[model samples]
Target: MTRDRVPHILILGGGYVGMYTALGLQKKLRRGQARITVVDPRSYMTYQPFLPEASAGALEPRHVVVPLRRVLRKCDVITGRITSIAHGDKAVTIEPEAGEPYQLEYDILVVALGSIPRTLPIPGLADNGIGFKQVEEAIALRNHVLDRLDIAASTTDEDVRRRALTFVFVGGGFAGAEALGELENMAQYARRYYPQIGAKDMRWVLVDAADRILPEVGDEMGVYTVEELSKRGIEIRLKTFLESCVDGHVVLSKGKPFDADTIVWTAGVKANPVLADSDLPIDDRGRVSCAATMRVAGLDDAWAAGDNAAVPDLTDDDPDALCAPNAQHAVRQAKLLAKNIAATLNGGQPKEYRHKYVGSVASLGLYKGVAHVYGVKVKGFPAWFMHRTYHMSKMPTFNRKARVLVDWTMALLFRREVVTLGRMRMPREEFRRAATPKRSQRDGSN
Candidate 1:
């Protein structure tokens, strides 16, 4: 065996693409051929498909995320942001959590930085709306919804109670639909505990500019999804957009106005903005342009994948078709990307990536789902079962897979916990109260 100087391989993000691609390389490469380094803002990779379950308290939040250092022990992990990339010089500037920025050089570069939630210049979006991408957001949303129920139950003012119970979600894609489905189900289940609040007291409205929802599952399944959700008392406002949301007052394009305490924005995501600072060839959509082999176009020793790269969809016959930004393609692309990288290091030609779209499955809530797989359409319990089975198998590591399965098994045998720890948002409340003895003394006359 010929041993060569270690080639430093730098992965820009610790997302699904970066983490999985590094795992593949660790297994394929020899003893001392290359050194792998991963950089990201977070120390864990979230299994996004299971986020709705986490929010609904069906799965523990800890089980849905994989710790990066524990999983990638062989690689160097840095919790930092890549502020800029100078691909022409094979270097990047990183702004870590605490300290001055520094530059590092590498021989091989993998630009797997993922997408960011796309936002519009709406009136109250920045102050009121929350996103559905991270685990923390999911947990916060769960607590927020339960807290709203508590508020509604305790308050006598009709307007305050109505606003607290109303949830407005802007987007009709899988994220928005799944989030709305799981949360609505959770709220319904929780309503039984509140004697003052009933199912009729709560309202869920899903707004989307697009004419249809769940486009990934086909037109038939999409229509079925709308019908199923409508039967559950969810208002589907298609061909509508949020005109303004100033001061919690939601004004729709159809001239309907209402007040909602909660607003979730899951409309879409665009490629990470950092790509614009690099010298690499970026497409019009602000994504790094790559060939079918996952190699960056017009650049040597450079690779890109996931949502940040605009790789051609060779499986589709259409000349202008690009791969959709979904977990299915991201996971598969990581495997092929690792292979091509290893082949390049071994002085071999890289293979082009091509795969057929098998199908999609989305969970509506516990025991309810919709799936369209390989020309077969299934709904209700069967589809929900398939949803869990597919995502459980796709989870990154064996440890996570076992933990997730245990969570599900426990939910089957025991009742799901519905207690909301709203105090998580105010971690320092007790300390502040204890420190202020004068205020407590003044109010203790009762």
Candidate 2:
């Protein structure tokens, strides 16, 4: 804690809140006042909004993620997973590759290890379902979807073709809806190149437990979204839940059973599992319970925010309300949290964090979208344009913004890329086959 040595601030996770908070701290704090250290499994922070476009081949996967080291030059970044937070000892245990588990002591800790995909006890989900959270998953899903199309077109077996063409998405939120819409659009355009495959032949189903989708937007916009998707032949099963997906057989609570080759699970997210290992008080949903000021309840120096923090919604009149886990609140909370932290460190009273829900926008494939922003409802091309404009404006750096814009511009001037490189997922499979001893070669009897 010596002033000359610089006070250490350890931030767990390099997601939206973690990266932005560290960036804010580095810019605001004096050079020797504190040292900001960020620990995350990945070296980059993904711009998740553009993931659907990236998966659809409209945007390159590399352009969707921002490297942490490149952006956070002022702060020390650690590429490792935090195993445990020993708050009593003022230290955290991290397990990194090629090194023993080491402890890093800190004067202050920021718990921002964002949420993970909330998977249910549903069968086959762990084995077969793909998540749309990270950049690698998005790239894998894109390749897998395109590969399935290739398999369907080349095969004459009806059952194999049916399974290959069937795609099931279990969630109606932005991630599920946007990903399915974009990929379906890509597949539709891609089918033109395959003589055996057609848009009509593909089956796309979106299942949601809630009766409505895109609850961020009002009910009216949500209804409009459902109607529009319905017109596109995307099956919408409202008030239905996925009972199980054992062995590729998907069963719904509504009594339908079908086999689908591709199942993307974007139902929702829960707090990071590491939180449970810490001494921090968590809510019933396993999120760190925090005051509106972004301070952990009853903990003097600890703070939490973003998807993993259950911050009370002061803007709402309802007593039971908590802020929705979205980028809007997360970005705002990060700024306020940083200010509050700085204020506390400087002996000033921290301010409360309060903000009203602005609005919501969703992209539905290329040149199509739906939005309800500031009481105005927009759909189709205009909404799509607004969606792009809004996310581009909010995207972290100018370099990333420019790169994304360039990707979109290139998409406008050329046809979408539909090439599938499925072997990338398991490149050794081909090598394994090549290395196998064949019967003709083993006996030299051919």
Candidate 3:
């Protein structure tokens, strides 16, 4: 398509798909062959699996993120949200963080915009609920959890103390389960320093509409996770959902009611709403429809992957099945998508992306986990080791891997940092107040 100037490759959403796809292209394509431009709201890609550890203070929050521009030296990274795409004209409307919307022309388009948190219409949810998808939310939850401990230890009102100590999480997938486990583990350690509060003073509850937790690892492992969490005095509510969280009073579908200061929402995710405005083929669930080769169905120049794409699963014998949205598939799909794109660009035949499902591993806490690989099942320390080793190997870049290892090593040599920096959230409060004259001073001076 390039008669004179170089081809422009516009990649949407600098997440797992965008970042890895760009890396693959940089390695495969020749200089000036394709000018890659990545558009995302954030400048970095977050390693979501490590979010639980970051929230628990097991790893520094900054260590779990990869700077997009720093890694993709050959590509132009634009921190913005993609408004719409006109694939017919090979153009897109990009809304930058601090500028007017502009049209971006591209010969090749990669829609990796990814998914957003799927929220239900529940009372008071907007006022009290927090999500677990991003690094900021994880850090806020960490500080909020510790600050709750501080509140419980200092308060004399029984109701206030009880409310502050109660932590409620609504979901039982990898995100919810691991988050509850890690934070509970950290809270147990932090409780040691509080003379007024004991381990029994805190209440951790996990609720899910599904019958089992960690469904990716199969039934046996899921049951084992429930049992292990039960032994830690964590309450698991299956076949239930949150009805309301009005004014911090949570009401369950089972008719249980309780006052809670903390509410973490990790129910699930849906494709980014921006896709609804595009001309691409989207399925009923709002995911981009892609062929086995990861190219957008019926579109020669467009491709999609990750949580936002419904790619037919060739690995599954069932003809009706589509690839489950997860990091394992997303990472692998990014590579193949890039390869297929490159193949088409070079006038070569594109290959289909197919791989059997690799098994799942999840960390429960510092020295606890559950894993199922191939046909083998492991729990306790062995599973924990597998969890750490697998993620450490999968985490992008040698620099991040080294930093994560150092963080673990330091944790082993010393106690975990249990302090909360809640003040960081409102850093300008003191300054703002100091700048304002006192009421008495204002009157006397006048």
Candidate 4:
């Protein structure tokens, strides 16, 4: 390498860690210190915390995502997948969406590929179960739920109506609970528009293998979450597994098999398995082993964090404890990671990453929530308000923050929009139907 050549820093993902790290680096580094390049499959970074509200029509989907090219003006953004990484050669194979794979060399590599859904081999789950991770999934779930209401309202068959109105959510974690809370609230509100469907007609059930839900919040808050959902006529099933959902026939371990039209899977996530192919040191959970400094263990030029890396939890007494996979930790780690990289490039020492756990807050519905922060507990409206206030402040750009604020203000002034563009799923269906000829035309009767 020539002394005149600037160092190329490659970021593997444009998620919470990747995007924020680039944002920080672009600000912290000198004008000619390093050239930054961020590679991600999608062009935008999603604010996952706001996904539930967006799904429930309280916010727009586009507002929750920040376009990578627009935000990272100083960085070269590549919409491609990192197929393989050969750190020994300081290069990675990139697979663009429409082209053949190619190799890209860099002086430093940042792995923030994040995690994917941890799924099980339950019968019909692969065919029928829908996950609640990406914005697309959230939008699809909203459309499906509303479409079911339409079906139940129009159907005359009692069994069919019952099945159409039944919505089942598996996994009592943050995603499942929040999604269920918001969507159930939206569904209940939408019911008023349909005179045929009563409050009792629609069924909302939450199933979890563990005995508790929303464990991120506190024990008391978790219990309160269950009770609150119960008050809304939503059933909570704990210490139970989804034995099967063959053809929408939900069979639980301890209950009579019931048929549901919609099934949502929010069961945890696992680290990306591609890290192993890079020959990086990984923990048993498939996460890259990262030091307190957010650098890959035993490697100088490689860095990793977020859900894809097992970062030491310095705030914990347990030596083996790792940071929790959440937006709070990811955002903080990304900022530190950028500074650390810049410090190393400029012959300065990189600092360690450490932070004490503050607590947690979750939105149950519009004005309903639970929060446990700094040893203080708050429930209902106060908690809900805190959830919005805290996340909105943490939300990425001022542009997004203002857009989200406007969305909330408008929502308070008007009723929620209950329209479902379910056709977005299969957009070509209407076109295909319109282009197809009728039997009379086919037979030349007209």
Candidate 2 local lDDT, 291-344, one digit each (tens): 888888998878999999999999999977899888899989888888887888
TM-scores for all predictions: 0.96, 0.96, 0.97, 0.97
Candidate 2 lDDT score relative to the true structure: 0.90
Show the lowest summed lDDT stretch of 10 residues, model 3: 437-446
The CA lDDT at 420 in model 4 is 99
The Cα RMSD of model 4 versus the native structure comes to 1.7
Per-residue CA lDDT of model 1 for 248-271, tens digit only, reads 899999856999999999999999
Q: Where does the lowest 10-residue lDDT sum fall in candidate 2?
A: 437-446
Write candidate 3's Cα lDDT for 157-202 as tens digits: 9999999999999999999999999999999999989999976889
Q: In candidate 3, how many clashes are counted? A: 0
TM-score result, candidate 3: 0.97
Best by TM-score: 3
- 108-199 in candidate 4: lDDT tens per residue? 99999999899999999998999887888889999999999999989889999999999999999999999999999999999989999998
- The C-alpha lDDT values of all candidates are 0.92, 0.90, 0.93, 0.93
Query: Is 1 or 3 the stronger prediction by lDDT?
Result: 3
> After TM-score superposition, what is the CA distance of residue 191 in candidate 1 from its true location, in Å?
1.1
